[model samples]
Target: MPAPHILSVFDQDMDRLQAQILSMGGLVEEAIRDAALALETRDDELAARVVEGDKKIDALEEDINTAVVRVLALRSPAAGDLRTVITVMKVAGDLERLGDYAKNLGKRVPILAQAHRVEGAAASIKRLAKSVRLMLKDALDGYARKDLDLVRDVLQRDVEVDQMTNALFREFLTHMMEDPRSITSCMHLLFISKNLERMGDHVTEICEQIIYLETGTRPEARPKGTSTAQVDVPYPGSRT
Candidate 1:
């Protein structure tokens, strides 16, 4: 049997668009992990590379924005195609910001690497960063699969990252109160962990957007770190 003409063309277009989005996602994720690894290993060269590589991310963002505009203007896609375009637009922007945060984290690695040690300040936050990375991976997989249940799961898992962030902050404050020498390093570590947590939240936001774009219905309970807007998009592929 022959594939339906409209669906086939739409699928081809979506394939290209999704490939670009996934490529950007992979780049940003690698940047984040590299920045963290650079810090952990005290590899100034790697840290410097991460900081400098942000330029490529910026260029890629411009290309993506241009491509999205071209699709919107030329194809005038409707229904789920429309939703996917909008979601990709918003998600790419969020990913760009995520890259910025990763770059910032790399910039601060020099300070943490100054003594070849992070002392006690990184203890809890390290765990938090690792968990956030895991969440990011799962959320991206969910987005690619368009598995609403999996995204719903990502929504619920966000609270764990939040709790860990809060706990780490409390512990950081305790260290600050206990010893003057710990204040500076603990403060920097605090910012680092906060950035990581925020990126995790942004990933969750992307997943929620995927849900809205794919289903035209926001979940009754939005996942953690996401507050959704209910727009009057017509349900795509729905029969009356």
Candidate 2:
């Protein structure tokens, strides 16, 4: 094939791959949102739906991997396109693991989705959940638009989730130390918080991957005085 033909094929393939990644990311976001709602509303049915969405996410991951491998073999893409191929492969895996984390969150919903919820976890966990969901949403948007500043925003929100997780753990520990009854429920609460923290870590990884794709280099912390990295994150419901 001519170079232009190969390039055209590669472009089409990249578009398909991006679509697959976005689909997986969308499922992951839905799972996270529904899992939080399930716990808060004590709706076991919603939790079940989140679990099912997780299966679709897994399938999407498998399809993405297959698509990436096909492109790598056929296109042998070089330079910027090569970086994109590599970044996208890793990003897809990170997103898949993120889907698993969301599923884990859903699985735990039934435990806390009961008449008497664990003390100190309800409101705090809700806040943390919302923060993580927002981070995921922005992180995916950053990927689509190659938006570095938006990625930085997602990283900052990760710190917020981490801080909230620590606070919640401390509060839960203090309560359990005082009251023996909180042992089982507190452990469940810990599991949920830990998953949220790990999700934040994965979001950071995906953001870094997207950065690498755009810049052909691992992301270096931008010095304040130098020009800021130009990346556009598209947010649907807020001032741009």
Candidate 3:
């Protein structure tokens, strides 16, 4: 262990980085929840708020990037210190992507609200969104606490999100086939489900960074339940 005085400043820098990541994660989680709720409730105002909130997340990501860069330049950090800075930057990027997906979902709410609601679509979407949000919370908490077990749990949750997306895909397909009138609503629902699944993927990416930060090597073969070919949803159910 280094002397108390020298260690204090280093600890402060690390703590600040971790705190910023958690702050960003919180905004992202809120965005996901609000976006899903807006879709479910058809609240255009709430959806608009989610869109506007994306800017704050983007600004926070920029702040994190700047701070990480400055730390790298100012301090010739040891191997562990270097890993923390790099991992924070990676986690920030993942969180920013999650915000973008939420923003995309929010922006589509008005279009979806105008269409006829498909039976059971909103409930399924909410379930998917809730799972992704929980995984995100776990990933953020694990990183902040440096808890590898929590990170492992987050990694496993991504598989469930993918499975949910695949099931949603099949359901929407059946709906569209049964009622051509339901195409518009089913299409939007498919996109929302895909967005939520992608959010879970971003959470898993953050988990990977946390794992790497704690242990020098990356985790072996991250869990995945859906393949690109199977999930390549074109026009909400096109087999092509």
> Which clashing pairs does model 1 show?
none
Clash count (model 3, backbone only) = 0
TM-score of 2: 0.87
* Candidate 2: residue 138 Cα off by (Å): 1.0
Supply every candidate's count of residue pairs whose N, Cα or C atoms clash at under 3 angstroms.
0, 3, 0
Estimated TM-score for each candidate:
0.84, 0.87, 0.92
Point out the higher-scoring one by TM-score: 1 or 3.
3
Tens-place lDDT per residue, model 1, 31-64, is: 8888888777777888899899888887778887
lDDT of 2 by residue, 1-240 (tens): 698887898999999999888888888888888888887787888988888788888888889888888988888888888888877788889888888887887787787765245654766777788888888889889888878889877766766677777777767666666666777778788788878878878888887787777766776653221111222333335477
User: How would the candidate models be sorted by TM-score, starting from the highest?
Assistant: 3, 2, 1
lDDT of 3 by residue, 1-240 (tens): 556766677778878988888999999999999999998999999999999999999999999999888888766678888888888899899999999999999999999889877988888899999999999988888876778998998898789888988999988977887889899888888888878887887888888888878888889997688653465434545566
Identify the leading candidate in terms of TM-score. 3
Q: What is the C-alpha lDDT of each candidate?
A: 0.75, 0.77, 0.87
- Collision pairs in model 2: 147-231, 147-232, 148-231
Model 1 alpha-carbon miss at residue 204, Å: 1.2
Error of 2 at 205 (Å): 0.4
Model 3: lowest-lDDT 10 consecutive positions = 228-237
Clashing pairs in 3: none
